[model samples]
Target: MTDYVSTTPGLFPLPDWAKDDLSDLKGHQKHDLISGDEGEEITAAYEQARADVLEVQREADLDRVVEGQLRWDDMLAHPLAVHDAVETRGIVRYYDNNNFYREPVVTGDLEFDGDVAAELETVSELIDDDDDLQAVLPGPYSLFDLATDEHYGDDEEFLAAVGDFLAGELEAFPDHETLFLLEPSLVTDSPAEGLDELASEAIDTVAAATDADVVVQSYWGALEEKVHAHLLDADIDAVGYDFVSNQEDNLYNINEYGTADDISLGLVDGQNTLVEDPEAVRDRTDWVFDQLPVAEFDTVYLTTNTETFYLPYNKFEEKLAVLAEAASLAEVTPA
Candidate 1:
């Protein structure tokens, strides 16, 4: 076991490469890595990219290290994780510009694919050398939201199936500090009812199978009364609170969570290019720490939202350096 101190959360950049050897992973077919049409040319590049990120995280000495999401493999692997017997469809663009995904019409019997299991294990191996490295997975509620219903028919049944399947995946990663990340960009427009219960069941199902800590992340939702009420007794060690994606300057409704859990404070900008001010982040975190206990303050995490639209590969490293400074300061400052 590693001699790690579970005090003070730190910042992590979106898991893409900090310095692109050439350019963005766009234009390349999303499925190329898996099809083997691209072979090790694509696979080797991704592994190297992930290695670079691990080295950077090591140098920064972050409390948590993410295995860089280089191949788009597993970043949003839900499209391939479900059973093919289930129908499939795509989500509508909620905004004038939104990233669209094609997914299964999951109505019943959510099952895990061998691919997702192997992907998570691959990520684990990438960062396994780092003592603080934590593996990530798409949260059940968020996955259910993106998973559409075409032929399967019933929305509620689809959600129930997803819940069941996630329970199985959680069991697969039994011993490591796997941190599941739920991306509910749809929350910006339509956050569902009973999210807390939905999220709790998903986490509990996995917890029964594994010792890993489950973390619920809602990257873009505004934590209004209803959302807060739902999260009040969330059953997990960490609950992600996104000020960056929600565009809130501070943690406004965190107290709504009646339970004391770890708070992942998203401090960097994931959807845009404005590098944040280090001092500003420090002040905002101070305000949030005031709401929770001083001891618990150490449990607060720092990160950008799910993706890195903030900067290109080269510039992202510069931005990460600044956020690192803020996380360091947050440790000494009082709530």
Candidate 2:
């Protein structure tokens, strides 16, 4: 039987109490807090939120837990926008969704000043086992696609710079078992001509910085054949596909080109409120496995199609519970 691991790709919905606390906080206090600086009160609020989020995952008995990314107001651009070298410009729609993020405009040479290390540190303290901790970050290609480059003249140079900056940021992270590099843009807005090779190189650079198993998880849709091919060339443990959104195309790519030993299946719809039944999720897993040329996998991750930030906190928790139960059911299934 294949061992199924239930996990989330981080960026979870904030609980009601945390939302209330943040809403009541002074503007400057909230700014300082999310920007990596902190006051006693704001810090306490963030810590409480993180603790509560971790507890939810523990209750579900998931194999791995994420930091929940409760403080990321701007989503993927939050880390870059907060950096001194990057400027926050006009608002831009985040993919085809109604949500928007302040576009990160690179104005100076990019540098990492402990972007996600603090969040990881707090999470490490909350969990007993270090190996259970998972860190999620925006992939280099996604960051490049979303941002407006001003410092680097050439597109390839900017792409390489983004990769290097992210690698530097990862150097300071606390010990983690897995790293999920969220690369939605690779599917949402495919890379331009001749840039796929550079994009893969950037991904490899970031993957090399951490000892943890890396999964370059893309969402919204599956990549085109060529882009998918280049992505497979990266030195990474696994690749994630959004099965909920583009299942047929994703399966085609996987069956045609083949994938790594391990892969993540986004079995649940993250943006939707209706929770899936565990048996149904298990059935879906079985179907995906049967469709594959090779049914066996080293590890099959049952996760949401995208970050759960769009859903209510209760809904998010329910999805986690479903994934955990589904994984348990799959574990007992015969190979």
Candidate 3:
């Protein structure tokens, strides 16, 4: 009903194929393609790895593919570039790599190395090649979640700075770079009140910065009205929802995501190891359509919640097949 993009569930790190400069490299590291390298061979090696990643993705049975976010370490890792513009203090350490069910709090100001802007051109090009592809940016709040608050007095100031930086990158993606995708997972991870405030600053900033339809995602599983109200009010083009693992306990508010102008319903379980039942997911989609206007369903999208898939490369294709089959059975249009 919504925009069509099948997933092997959660986003897997991108394959080399999606990257430009990496050449023919394959596997997970393929996702990290930077412009400059140690030398021609290193660059060449990166390129080789890059090309293989793309091939795997291209051959992948997915719709509205995400280029594997092969470039990102997870949304939290994105705003690290802010280190350049704002000098912050804090040693970043994860309590757990598998940590996601709850909010991952940052006790200090996270450093910034704003150098990531340099890769915008590559991101844009990849997204452009696949219009159905969704792009990602760190939510200002997530940056807040991770930033070490040293130079910045408090979270608010840190957010303000991150929001400003995010706005330019989001705007640049489609024009100076690629089509676009903005995933704000932080809102779903915390109380809607505080996260909403951060969402407002970040969303409005990017919304004003670009005309590309913004698709704000809440993969943190906080499927409550409060989590999404700000996005709706922000006038963002769409909001994404995930029912992959735990469907939010509250159903009344769930309708907002589907009924709201443009929403991507994440039925494919992107994070779990269990392969989803396409038919079952379709049934859920059916129920969703009852509450939302079937005619307006074009605004909806179907995908896995997030990309930090922990699986190794070999198993992705089969997982991808499951995702593709689910989408096909659900009868969602393929991208």
Error of 3 at 309 (Å): 3.0
Candidate lDDT (C-alpha), each: 0.54, 0.89, 0.52
Which scores better on lDDT, 1 or 3?
1
Can you give the TM-score per candidate against the true fold? 0.75, 0.96, 0.71
Steric overlap count per candidate: 4, 0, 45
RMSD (Cα, Å) of model 3: 6.2
Predicted candidate 2 versus true structure: per-residue lDDT over 1-335, tens digit per residue: 46688999899988999888777774657667546576788778888999999999999999899999887778987778788988887989988888889899999999876858888898898789998989999999999998999889889999999999999999899999999999999998898778988999999999999999899999998998988999999999899999999989999999999998799999999999999999999999988888887877788888998999999999999999999999999888844
User: For model 2, where is the 10-residue window of minimal lDDT?
Assistant: 26-35
Looking at model 3, which ten-residue stretch has the lowest summed lDDT? 28-37
Candidate 2 has an lDDT of 0.89
lDDT per residue for candidate 1 within 19-42, as digits (tens), equals 353134423644762333544455
Query: Arrange candidates by lDDT, highest first: which order?
Result: 2, 1, 3
Best by lDDT: 2
